[model samples]
Target: MFAASIKSKTQSLRLQSSRLMPLSQQYRAQSNLSNNKSYWSHIPSWKGVSNDEFVSYRWQLRNTVSDKLKLYKFLDEVLPERLGSTENEQLKRIRTRTNFIEDAIAAIKLAPMAIRLTPHVLSLIDWNNPLDDPIRRQFLPLRSSIIPDHKYLELDSLHEEQDSPVPGLVHRYPGRALFLATSICPVYCRFCTRSYAVGGNTDTVSKKPQKPSRKRWEVVFEHIANDKSLQDIVVSGGDSYFLQPDHVREIGERLLDIPHIKRVRFASKGLAVAPGRILDDSDPWTDNLIAVSNKGREMGKQVCLHTHINHANEITWITRLAANKLFKHGVIVRNQSVLLKGVNNTFTALSDLIKSLSDINIQPYYVYQCDMVQGIEDLRTPLHEIIDLDKQIRGTLSGFMMPSFVIDLPGGGGKRLVSTYEKYEHGIATYKAPGLPGAKGEMTYTYHDPKPVKTAVLEEFQQRQLEALERGETLEQFFAQSAAHLPRSPLPNPSSNQNPLRPQTTSTDIVPEFWAPTPKPAYAYSQGM
Candidate 1:
């Protein structure tokens, strides 16, 4: 009877697997539109350009729309007058308000991750409706970035620097290492996690580290070579692809030489932002990548390309072409996306994105909660919302299509499954997980809103004031009565360490309290009073 039960379970598992196989195959078939000329014809910029020039990676790089002025000129030609005028006004305002310090900071941040959008990606923007365009939102700077409320946000949100033993290499996970190969990309994302470092900015918000030199790289390679435990290495930075093709090949070869290194993964947004770089067979970069993949195959090691793409609209004909090229070279392609609030946060948007990736043979890997980087509060969604969205979409997506919704805990705690909220209270959720750095046995983390939390007392004060007015009390009388009942205390000296609102603990594990307002008297309210 036990044998029969085991047989039944195995059969059930096989049946489920078979059911999922066909859906993936079907999507792959639907995604192949190489013969579809109509789709390419609709892009206005693609008109008058021969297929050879359109597919040339060099041409794409040479014609990138880099500066604000260049982007404006392109928009002026393609967008409606009204939309163009609005964008121009916003840009003009930003330019007018720029000061020396602000300009210095912007220059610093943009240095490592310079803005350079290829024509193919530029054409993907819906110029008539740029406000809601996910692609546009990802690359373009916004006015909300200048808001002062974001001062409390951390410059190094993930504390990646704290985990790094070397200048370029971050050995965070036990078996995996992160190699920051370059500090450049085709286009700079406004919410880039490494905005403090990657761009060639000399004046960074965080403690700026020196650029990785050949000598520094030698030290990094030596460190990896000496470590036997590390089996996987993630080659990334501004974008790994931004490194010269020969340099990329050399890095891959060096990693493969390390006996314990079983897998080497390259992370880049270039596949989506500048597909022609790898899609064009004539491009030297494409050839070099192919050679590297071939070498990895020879060594019996896994070589993969993990591309960053947030929206389904980003998966275009060129993206598919690039993915297919990598596929042919025996490089497994996957996607890792950030769950930006207005970007791909909804179930429908995420569903479409993963499905589109699956259609092109790109496995959906991780959907990370946006980090608490300074000036990026607008992009982050509440943890509960991210968890709910994951739950809503889990049952509907194919197992391969469902990416893990993860949050890298602040202060080098490593990645945690966002769904693992052990307890929720007062807009704060507690997550307990083992093996977290600096945690003692089942470490508990508290996640709260970045915005100021309104205390119950404050709410009650407002409510009582409203009720007093309904009873026909004058504003002065209400204030006078309230003041009479309130408790008095000696004002704190500016130099004292008597802050009641700040966390009093000495433990480094504590998350700082977001509220820092002056203390108020405790209030007691009775139902009939």
Candidate 2:
């Protein structure tokens, strides 16, 4: 009984560490069909909605099968004639959108036992032909909004010039490297930035596109072996986790052998699109993942997982359960979101995403400006809006939850921050530090203030702080004394009387007087917004 209780408590702690409550007991809460069947039925299944309604619903159900297909069709039909005549001659007016049944079967046949399929999977398909608005109301999809084309253009240009250390590898950052581990994804998105790497398109500019073979991975390992500066490697492809568990573990074990490579992370959206792949007990692949993650932990290397989840709704019960499995087995999870137009562009949407990620114990790390990729011009929200959204999100959520808004600089220059309202420059910004209002020596203060008056405020507060200390007052008592009176001496000692630790000086010293704060160039300010 005691051992069982201990096991229960340990499991509970493990769930808590993953930043979500125990979900094994909450499976019933995640019925996808319970309230969604009716909603999904009304959205005009792949048959296509009217042009007006079709475009309107593009952002609304960006992730859904019907919605993505419609958008792809719209682009195929409209973009070439409307915006760029270049794309017109290349393809048909409405290119066929591949459904899961056909695509999954094709993928399975290519690599037998690569992935599992259940009979219930077919039931999950929406075969109903009728459009039902009442049922659609239950899903409450994202609102529609316009985004610019430059976002993808910028991402393309940046990545184009970046040096490829090996085939399918991007080594832009100093300490970290990105490996395009594969070209296959369980589900393909039209806006995928790694266009060349995914969907079996091997025309990546730098490297020759050949069929993925073990020999190629060996080269990747060799590159890592020589690069002493590269301490972290991010395994990303169309989706690294989409590879068979043996393939995944093989990469993990190979990465583990590199003593200098302290961290190996898999960047994927698989957990969102196909959580079953990670959790099904009948699948040997699941055990392989667990083994890989455990081996990573045992080797004293950080086994991290960076998943892409754009909205809160995507964190279904199955995803939560799967995340717990990864965490309990010792893989840390983090989320990197693209700030796409119409989808999570608002503060509320961003906040909810952050909160949900935090609730599941996954750190919300990067709120990236959408990548500039072809056919995704409509998805880029303005950078300024992302800045404002970041401002609103800063105080509302925990530091871990609030992700940094950044735009990968054009021409592969590097990532630059999309400035928030805080206007932080040169790593100099102020927040209300410790101490309460009206506390003796405590006063309204500006942190990192450049002016003398602001400097005097800190000085006076420190003086009073010392005097209060000599009186044998505890730090709490000192703050209370400064805070005791009703806002009197709104400006405490302008000199240094507040703190007795140092001599009071009225005139500001020129030589050592004011710390010359680093001046932020105008271009830095202009770039973020």
**Evaluated with TM-score, which candidate comes out highest?**
1
For model 1, residues 195-224, the per-residue Cα lDDT tens digits are 656554321232243343678789889999
Tens digits of per-residue lDDT, candidate 2, 28-110, equal 23433233222222333433433223222122234333333433443233122222111312111222233312222222221
What's the lDDT for residue 329 in model 1? Answer: 51
Top-lDDT structure, candidate number: 1
In order, what is each prediction's RMSD in angstroms? 15.5, 21.7
Which runs in model 1 stand beyond 4 Å of their true positions?
1-47, 84-114, 144-152, 202-212, 436-446, 450-529
Predicted structure 2: lDDT: 0.50
TM-score of each: 0.71, 0.55
